[model samples]
Target: MQDVKADVYVPGHGPILKGASALDRHIKFYKDLRNIIKDAINDNIEATKISVPDTFGEPDEGRKNMTVETWLKFYG
Candidate 1:
């Protein structure tokens, strides 16, 4: 996104985002989530015990457990 120099971003979901700052925030979000899951795996945290930060934005409650399960399947 930074290399492309786009003025706006159309995400897979949610409202349309504008500006580079929006892209930066999106990048940070995924990076943060990846790191959190990685750390949890390293610490031997159970999939059922892993948690996302409350401040990470409003995620779908129904998909939260599935997300953790998918992450563990690939990275665990």
Candidate 2:
């Protein structure tokens, strides 16, 4: 992070962030993803249920949201 004067950087799992704030972003991402998937499944959006899950991994409520197994079930 000290390599340059960059104010914000996007980590692997979170949005563009500065230091510790990235952790929170990642958590929110998972929670939101979980809700999105659950909504899609309930709505019977068959296409999205397959494709979105592929791109977005598993749904994690509090860090255990998404898993590889979850993704494989649809878009694997």
Identify the leading candidate in terms of TM-score.
Answer: 1
Question: What's the TM for model 1?
Answer: 0.72
**TM per prediction:** 0.72, 0.41
**Which stretches of candidate 2 lie above 4 Å from their native place?**
1-18, 49-76
Best by lDDT: 1
Whole-model alpha-carbon lDDT for candidate 1 = 0.77
Taken over the whole model, the C-alpha lDDT of each candidate is 0.77, 0.51
RMSD of 2: 10.2
Q: Summarize candidate 2's per-residue lDDT along 1-76 as a digit string, tens digits.
A: 4354555776665556765555455656556656665665666655333323333464454433334237435532
Weakest ten-residue segment in model 1 by summed lDDT: 53-62
Model 1 agreement with the true structure over 1-76: per-residue lDDT tens digits: 5777788888788667798888877787667778879999899988777776544565686677887888777777
